[model samples]
Target: MLLQLISHSLGWLSAQVSAKAQDALIAVLSSGPVPQHVAFILDGNRRYARSKNMQIKEGHTDGFYTLRKMLEVCIHMNVRCVTAYTFSIENFKRSPAEVDALMDLAEEKLLELCQKGDILDKYGIKLVVVGHRDMLPERVKAAAEKAEEMTKNNDRAIFNLCMPYTSRDEIATAVQSTIHERLDEDADDTVTADDIEAHLMTSLSGSPPLDILVRTSGVKRLSDYLLWQCSEDTQLQFSSTYWPEFGMWDFVPIILDYQRKVWSKA
Candidate 1:
């Protein structure tokens, strides 16, 4: 029995060392290329909170700070745009208390950004939000509007916050806009994909297609985010680490892998 127990302990230790070695290998092997616009699903907040026996509100609070730090790395890497899926349209299905908490947190963060926060004022980063705003509360909408107004002139970087969004809704909204924009043309003229893309609510100035998308917590699903934007050229990297737990170490390696992938295929 003693020998067996010792054997099991050794096996566990070996596995842990192997896992670290693999991460290091991934870091070393993947390097040198970064994406122009990187979008993140920002999933697993509730799970993270629950696992730690914390309230759902804490999850959003933690996520907000995590996103801010990621943006700093994005700016350091010279990424032109970073689109984050903040609140999905389907997220309303969650409990009302949780939903309300999210809305409050988001509004507060937006207000902070609009108030000339450290990052926004110092770096001159432009803040933008997309998705169904009409469904949002007045205060939330006002916060978004205020942020947009304050950052309308700044051009250093784009912080696209997707609120109450989904690919289906975005596609439908873009289609409607196309019809409105091209009213003079015959409806039967047959609109192409580009025409539809031109109308999507992603913002006017250079909302280019995302090159690399990463989702955390080991989940491998789009969850109705960024449908039309991710083309064949896009690369996705998934991690088991939760979003709140995600750090620059995770981001730096992923960017390096992206750069290598882009250049290798060229």
Candidate 2:
């Protein structure tokens, strides 16, 4: 009982310190060039699980929790749009068991997104799952659709879940959609860059292109996420920490660095 009490007290104290630090950081950096849209390439779940000798599901669960925390932080920081690479189309190549687990997690998370106290309604954040719905499991796809419907009227912030998504696939689909729409209208057959952008799956947010794209776990490459949406001016920040270990406090420093370094240059 005494040990538990001590642990609880310490946790409370830590949270207090964290809260104060976060507020200070925000006060200083909020007036700076905050990202209008931020996207995350969440990596290192499996590696983290392996390192800890824990079940892969646990790592992914932690990653999801991190994502929730991230959204709250971004909203507080006044970021307009947030996109996450939840499940890539290429993830289908993983072991059947792992893929099944991911699908189950997605279905569960989507349901959670609609519940009270989950922040969707609290913050008026709209949720959109952009991907190939036909390729997803029925239950998962249904949950995503329901979540989108529930939050369709929200306008405060846009949250995009890139499930079963790939930049290459999205680009190709945009091209096809643009062409088909042009044909249906009996208009010009030429497909311009604007035409493709108009039909992009992720562009539903109607926000500016990504101003900041972060890939955690030390990976430098985009791994096929937001390939076209990240403009040349977008600041790409790579973190050494795993997604599960990333927090709003950790993110503040990166953004501050970007302001001092990248934004100044631009």
Q: TM-score per candidate, in order?
A: 0.85, 0.94
For model 2, how does the per-residue alpha-carbon lDDT over 185-259 read when each residue is reduced to its tens digit? 999888889889878887765766788899999989998888888857688889999999898767987788777
lDDT of every predicted structure (CA atoms): 0.83, 0.88
List clashing residue pairs in candidate 1: 33-259, 34-259
Those runs of model 2 whose alpha carbons end farther than 4 Å from true positions after fitting are 261-266
Among all windows of 10 consecutive residues in model 1, the one with the lowest summed lDDT is 25-34
lDDT value for model 1: 0.83
lDDT of each residue in 14-113, candidate 1, tens digit only = 9899767756654554344556788998977888999999998998799899999888767766678999999998989999998899999989999897
Error of 1 at 35 (Å): 1.5
CA RMSD (A), model 2: 1.6
State in Å the error of residue 110, model 1.
0.5
